[model samples]
Target: MEFDEERVALYETILDELSPPDGEAVSSAHFEKELELENAYQAIEDLIRLGELEIVNTNCGHVRVRLQKPVPSSTPSTRLEDFSENTVWLAYIVSGSSPRQRRAQRLFQNFEVGEEHLANISHTDSLAQVPGLEDVWCEEVKGLSTEYAILRKEYVFEQADDPWP
Candidate 1:
């Protein structure tokens, strides 16, 4: 598709200013000033829609736009499965302790408690009542005892109101 020259130039300018050495997202404001574009947002949208650019977040105030060359798709991976409909999972980690390990311990303990509570509920009622409780599983666990924890739990879904959901 033929793209507007001015918009393409603006996108190029933005990409030049934001291209990361490590290949990361750039901010939106910086590109606006560098390109001297009056309407960066509209210009960005146009370029993206034309398949000439992509937006990346650099964790700063603005977003980065990168020039992207399209490539033809090859054979798709069959092993990839879509579980967006079947699972409900939540993960949380605590922040800020002198020793990072201690915070992790606390996070794990909290997760364990949540897991146990759900397990009890599942046993007492049909998994349907628990919403997303399919084959409940803990994918990862880390924490400092009683202080912090990181816990991940997944449940299967039969309906919108499943226990895990």
Candidate 2:
């Protein structure tokens, strides 16, 4: 049977959060608290079925499990600092303008020239989501784009994509 990719992705993210280092046991209560879903109980079930986790023990209502495999790091190796401090990230949102991007642009407005100037900056085609930059970009873009991403930037150029980028 086919599973919803979005649901599977969400499940994976929860698993990542709960996964213990070196297959050590992690408290199931912690998982439920972090997940904050009515049906979070099923997530552990699904993970077990997928072989991503195995229940090590159960005490009362609490469950303990460990990662079957380690999750790979998503952070890039080059390090943004390896480039110039002037290096910035841009994402093309589907709509004409993004409030989140606009707000974020304002923070760097003094530093940014314009999107046209992107031609002068050295950049790569790769994309990554930056953490702890919520003040600049919206953590979630509700209407236009289904996926939310953060990029460090001097200038931004937005484009649109469906379901996933």
Candidate 3:
């Protein structure tokens, strides 16, 4: 897909300025000053789609960015099976005590519960390894725990609501 060069340039400038010399993550909102909010937003989407950048949206709706090229040396490995074995399954039951229960149908549990058995998800794909769960979506977890992790497709709500409208 053809992209607007000017907009792309603006996005690069924003990232370069906000990102550290060692290329740490940058927030997409930083482009608001140089481009209209919509254009800035699209720039980030376009960049990510083109594989020029990788994005992680935080629970607070902030888009975080990092260069896709050169790749981060410490990024989670691509081996889904390996990660799945190390994590403990925590299903997000609607009536469960966990705060994440209502946000989505179930979460691919991340974050420590102060127990050795509780597992942390290393990547989004790792959730697919969970038995009986399919079409998982990577999303930001809120409430009891704040993290960018995966969720089962059945649990992903298009509109935020209680009791699954």
Query: Judged by lDDT, which candidate is best?
Result: 2
Clashing pairs in 3: 88-119, 105-155
Stretches > 4 Å off in candidate 1 = 1-4, 18-22, 58-62, 67-165
Task: Give the alpha-carbon lDDT of every model.
Answer: 0.38, 0.41, 0.39
Q: Rank the models by TM-score, top first.
A: 2, 3, 1
Task: Please give the TM-score that candidate 3 achieves against the real structure.
Answer: 0.34
* Global CA lDDT computed for model 3: 0.39
In model 3, state the lDDT of residue 32.
62
Q: Please identify which of the two predictions, 1 or 2, would achieve the higher lDDT against the true structure.
A: 2
Order candidates by lDDT, high to low: 2, 3, 1
The stretch of ten residues in a row with the least summed lDDT in candidate 1 is 124-133
Model 1 residue 158 lDDT score: 50
| Candidate 3 local lDDT, residue 16 | 58
True-structure RMSD for candidate 2:
15.7
Candidate 1: C-alpha RMSD to true structure equals 17.1
Worst 10 contiguous positions by lDDT, candidate 2: 156-165
Estimate, for each residue in 51-131, the C-alpha lDDT of model 2 and write its tens digit: 345678889786787754333333443122122333353433311232123222212343233332222231223333222
lDDT of 3 by residue, 1-165 (tens): 222466646556655554332346667666664444557766565444333456644445557776542312333432121223323333332212222223222333443321112123222223222221122223333336444343332222223322101
